[model samples]
Target: MMKMNDVAKLANVSPATVSRVICHPELVSEETRSKVLEVINQVNYKPHIVARQFRTQKTRNILVVVPDITSAFFSKVLRGIEHVALKNGYQVILGDTENNIEREKDYVDLLLQKQVDGMILLTARQDKVRLEELSTQFPLVLACEYIDGLNVPTVSIDNVSSARKATEHLISLGHTKIAHISGSINVILSRDRLRGFKQAMMSQNLEVESSYIQEGDFKFESGYHQMMKLLALEVPPTAVFAFNDEMALGAIKAAKDSGVNVPNDLAVVGFDNIKMSSINEPSITTIDQPKYEIGKKAMEILLKLINNQELHNKKIVFKDELIVRGSTRKEIDVKETLEMV
Candidate 1:
């Protein structure tokens, strides 16, 4: 293993300067920084992360807790976090809560016992009172999901505004009887999205009928079942908006199985523009939350907090995009004319 002393001798700079180059490169002159980097690369210098952690009282390890690791939505976020963490010479430890409050609490306790430098949380539950107590001892960041009034730093999209935009898009498409399928209402994301949906409908002078709204667990099966129930309503909705892409896909599947022609008999829109949404038949029109960027930004914030650096900005909000596709189309004439031309 190449030591900092060897790099210092090779670059003719102090070991402290070498450390500064590795950790705080901006403080050193560009010429000196480049010289130290060149020597580091030549010698394949690998810093002793454990020793550094012990000396600095930082583990240089961050725990990222997700509700479900299998979801494609979260996988993209994980990739983003990994990119930033690896670049910063920090290690990320994953904790999959499976949406279980007890399991989430257990993971938090374990990570704290291990003395991790910080934590990035996606599975924030209302029962995180214990975790809140732990934050007094260590830094914590909330990603994707937030706990209202928690005073924790968070990185997320503006769910309320984006959901309103999505609903307004449907309204612009001449959909008056728009329905909504949502995740658990207890979660902040779900509550905000639901509020947005209602606000959009109310703004347009459209009644938000409780009978048209369905609740799901943000799962494919939950979506499928909920859509089936909605389809059985006395006055079935002509359009439906799902809180996430998986639910939207599930609704599509249910509509097809029920012999309903999509965008003709039904128009479906989803959130979180996951990859499958674009590839699915009649491709879903959905809100594109920058999942990967959210993950990366969250990790970046966590790393800064872990290093005890001043975070110039505490809350980071990513923008959302609306992707139009065939699933929500009400007319083929415009598309046909464009294609012919």
Candidate 2:
């Protein structure tokens, strides 16, 4: 019920001054802005968001399309995006595609129709033709995931290098019989991680056994099932590397159910370093991608695109860190490594 005019009168300032104080506080004088803010707080004044949107021709709404909302990997990223967006007086609308191309496309269409000012996508599965067409009409930035050979602006970590580091950690831990639990091969991150896995094996003069690698859908259940298959192999792996923390946790559960002693019998490592990783019975060793920073940077880039500002490149790659924990003990040395088929 509080009005801007009432605040302006109480502050003894003109309505235009009050408008600047609310919309562009930085442009107003410190003393005047302070007075207006005091009156605003005293009256519990609320801005008419709808009226402002109508006047500014901006919805102040951004759509974030994620592959899965339930994954802890995305929770920090969303927090970062929300932090930056709220500070800039914008709102975020979230859409979960569940890694389904059709669902992704549907959300894209719906957000477009809703006239959101910009969009940040963590699922970039749209066909090249469609993506090119959409990019021409709207401000869009890809986050976490990206389409190969596309010019869309993206924010993500160096997947290949981080994955290689993870594998190398296992190799240095006296484990040559290292198996990999890969995510869906179609995703770029999955392919990159697989490539890194092979590269690490070859670097150490170890044989790359195709049978030692299994594919999962990046889900706990898929990881559980794939790990079971790995355990049943005639020559079981001495250590396993999962594509993400969620899968690694699932694999850990499977290992426990089969009475396998972690690290002692089978070392395990995961990626993404989700919060749960540290709290697991045997804390997981994994790669930590700056999930929150990735989200914040993606939104910052999209905001620039919306304003038609020049961006140096369409691709932005973030750095990753390898965090060692109890799941992969550091006491073991390379001299004790076993030879594999």
TM-score of each: 0.85, 0.89
**Most TM-score-accurate candidate:** 2
lDDT by candidate, in order shown: 0.86, 0.87
The segments of candidate 2 whose C-alpha lies over 4 angstroms from its true place after superposition are: 10-14, 17-50, 330-341
Tens digits of per-residue lDDT for model 1 on 1-341? 77899999999999999987766554689899889888998999988877776666656677888998878799899999999986665678999998887788877875668667788889788465765776666788889998776767789989999999999999998999999999998788999999999999999999999988999999998889999999999889999999999999999999999998898889999999999999999899999988888988898788777667788877788889999998898666788889999
Summed backbone clashes in each candidate are: 0, 0
Report the CA-based lDDT of candidate 2 relative to the real structure. 0.87
lDDT of 2 by residue, 250-338 (tens): 88898999888787888999999999999998999999999999999998888788778999978999989999999988445456654
Model 1 lDDT, full chain set: 0.86
